[model samples]
Target: MNFEHSDKVKELIAKLEAFMDAHIYPVERDYYDFVHDHSNLWKEWPKMEALKDKAKAEGLWNLFLPHEYGEFSPGLTNLEYAPLAEIMGRVPWSSQVFNCSAPDTGNMEVLARYGTPEQQKRWLRPLLNGEIRSAYVMTEPQVASSDATNLELTILPDGDDYVLNGRKWWISNARHPRCDLFLVMGKTLPNNPRHSQHSTIIVPRDTPGVKIVRSQTIFGSLNSPGGESELRFENVRVPKANMILGEGRGFEIAQGRLGPGRIHHCMRSIGQAQRALEVMSRRADNRVAFGKKLSDQSSIRQDVARSFCEIEMARLLTLKAADQMDRYGNKVAKDLIAAIKVVAPQMAQTVADRGIQIHGGMGVSDDTPIAYFLTLNRYLRLADGPDEVHMSQLGKQKIREYNAMKARPAESRP
Candidate 1:
């Protein structure tokens, strides 16, 4: 509940800022150009690897992880690491330099919390070392994935292995050449309790029956780094050893991993919103119309004011959620997570839209990152779970609390 970050987090923030200024910002254009120009979206750009090595050598690697996984993580708590994630969020790809990017961050948490020693040695170690990448194959093309229980992929047991048969879409990281493993969630026992029917199993990307139907685009753009993809699993055989945690426990593992993952995105969105507001403020001050600076214009000033309020509100909410997750458990903080999952992305998207408006024509064009920011932050509203899903869940939780309070013994009321 403390408002200020700990001293260690401040130090990391300083170093992270310096690293971004020197390495990331200087080549932001080149980085995007190199990756976007490739005919194949999956190919690697060597500069990314070099920058990653430099970041690792500087001791910024694996900073997103908590103390429980000291073998590979930096051992910082979620509250301590949120600020660092925000700094990296200023530039979309910057987090990857420190190996703190998503899907990877979430996948790492799952492995640390649920993987067996042998599984960890084979997959988690390489991921920690940045030797490979991964994808979470859960959402299906045929079903309404928002429910998650609607996942229809079959994980049928065969001799010594599990055979996967289904199709998944909007899967991040699936198109990357380095993404060698898939942490797939599917129904192993349809007859079990709805929440307990699904299980997570690790399937190698090159498994015999796997097929990538195509790479998907987000808002008419398929930027590299982590491209959206569609994949088909036709009797893909994976060793039973690849099952994570246990059968009928995929939702449990997912819920555990999602707490940190969702908050991390919120932290980064705050940072992005902060940067967009900064850009907007300067633009208002520097640009002039009708013989007066935009800053002097009431409407422009109001935009700045509104943006500042939203950024502060979103940041505090995220911090509160992280604090709750650390003190209690993710289950206790689920509603807060859902709240931020809805708020943060919308905050960033609004800030991005205002920033774009301030920039006028250049905003929507590739001349600035504003357009991309607007698009991606908007997409985030639908990412982990869409706004409707989270809002509905939060609404239900509030009602439950209200009803419980009303039903309590009269003497218990204040």
Candidate 2:
């Protein structure tokens, strides 16, 4: 398939890259310093707010939304948006400036796709305007979360309302001061078949009995504004109108939500790997050891070459997945999505490791972004579904196909 970027995509990429160079990259230090100086780490950093306002005014806002929302976005196709996502990936936190951050992007998609008019007006509108942020609450503390149907949270029917009770951790963006809503999943009918029992409902953050138990940490970083959090819902109540789609359709919604989310992560990860390779190559070229440039060392050269090859492979696979989604729908592209989900994180992690090795002690420290990059990429192995889980599913599917072929008559078989 032809994967060339269209003229429109190229223009958007140029705009995004220029925006990053002019604003984001230069302020990385200042942004960190501002957060460190602020006593309430959860509060929005001033520099981020300023940049967000600038980005919104410049019409670079909400580039992630594909479906038409009147005048809200350009509604670019999935393939068209992939390269732009790569540019945003160069700076991990910069996607939010253009209102394209995760969890929020996925949540917005849910509302846009399934929410009623009332739901859209109440939540989706503000989200499109960048007035607030939201989170997804699905994983639980007591289960093997890889199998989402194993989730044991309950959404009980009460007179004219539903009461939610569960414990969820790794609820990203929940700790952000501006995060005021959640798209929560729980079993609405425990007696139903496993996949058909769960449902998703929108719950406001301030509803009674909803508690933010504490912020969870990733590799000891607690000061992050989008800090992962553990939430407890003890009889938290919301109107029945909060249900999206209908009861017993949570799995369907999740499938649609995660298809886009997974590819978006891959696109950004290509950029992360690209940045790491840049750092590694520059270091190898200029750093001298034992009277020779590191670039002259055989091991260093091999790593650089390998990193380049791996990044290209991952990027092409990701683009192919995007194209399949555009042409055949997400269900038709499930295998491709799982493949890239496995490939991209490993590629980024490998590139980050090589960058760290080239930088020596400086890489492991906060002096460079390598350590953070490594941490983020490594966690992605378990993000949507773990590598092992995807591999298992893919393996089973292949085995089924092989068995079916073997069972066929000789003329019908290959």
Candidate 3:
């Protein structure tokens, strides 16, 4: 019920904001320009390493990993990491500067929590040190990937290796220059129970038969440097030791990974919505339309007010989910996680739409981040799970809870 951040978190937030102000904001345009440039596709920005080093030197690295992985984690709880993530979310690319970007964050958490010692040493260590990047290769081209049980990739056993054959698309981070690993999910026990049929394995990006078929664009943008890619795993062979957790744990690992990941996405969307609102408000204040300032108009004021309310609501819900996850566990906090995942992205998309309307032509251009915010939030609506999916599950869960409560004796009911 406590709304205030603890002193430690407040300090971390201040430090993170100071770092962002000093380094990230100044080069935001330059970063965007490089990533959008066709010549720099899949190439790491020259200054990215230097920025990351600065973030590391300032002790702002790996703030996303909740578990204490010795020297890798800062030991912050999910609740503590939420605000810092929100700050980083303001500038989408800023998360990488602090080594707190997605796919890598979720991948590292999986390795830290479930990887074998050898697996940790080989992949987790370099990932933690930000020496390389990774991709979570799960979604497939020919299946209803939202329900992961529909994934059709095959990982049959060989003498001492697993041969993977599948097609995966929308694989984020696959195009990064230093993307050295892929946490690939495929069916290893197809005859097993539906939930237990799949397994996740670590495949080296340079391994034979790991082909980059094409880069997938989001609304015509390549999202360079770490663009989403379509990959073909044609007899891709990886050692048995590369299996994560075990043969039947892919679904379990994925569920665990996404709970935290969903919260992170929601908070980042809040940041994007917040920045869009600010940009819109500032534009309204400065622009004159129909003989008066846009800010003086009722519709503009209402748009700002509604956006503020929605952003605050989404942020509070995300923090609540984070707190519940920190105190209990992801399994217990599933409802709230689903709630935020369903709510935040749509909220951000709505706010960004309003911002775009207010800014007129400039809103859709690269001059402002509102256009990017719109794209990201819209994508988020379908990224983790579509709003409809979360809504359906959440609705069912709520009904079941109420039914169980009604089934209990009157004296036992709250």
Best by lDDT: 3
CA RMSD for every model?
A: 2.4, 2.4, 2.5
Cα TM-score of candidate 1: 0.96
lDDT of 3 by residue, 1-414 (tens): 688999998999999988888898999999988887888878998999999999999999998998556666789999899999999999998899888899899999999988998999999999989999999999998999999999899998999999999999999999899999999999999989999999999999999999999999899988888899999999999899999998978999999889988999888999999999999999999999899999999999999999999999999999999989988999999999999999999999999999999999998997999999999989998987889999999999999888776454665645
Residues 1-414, model 1: lDDT tens digits = 358778888898899999999999999898778788867456777788999999999999999888777777788887888888899998988888899998999999999888999999999999999999999888998999999999999998999999999999999988787998999999998999999999999999999999989888888878675788899999899889999988899999888878889999999898889888988788789998999998999988889999999999998888888778878878998999999999999999999999999988877986777787888899998889899999998999899888786465665656
**Native-to-model Cα distance after best TM-score fit, residue 218 in candidate 1, in Å:** 0.8
The segments of candidate 3 whose C-alpha lies over 4 angstroms from its true place after superposition are 68-71, 407-414
The full ranking of all candidates by lDDT, starting with the best, is 3, 1, 2
TM-score of 3: 0.97
Q: Worst lDDT window (10 residues) for model 1? A: 405-414
Best-first order by TM-score: 3, 1, 2
Model 3, residue 264: C-alpha shift (Å): 0.7
True lDDT of residue 113, candidate 3: 87
Model 2, span 182-241: residue lDDT tens: 999999988888899999999999899988899887887774687888999999999999
TM-score of 2: 0.95
Better-scoring candidate (lDDT), 1 or 2: 1
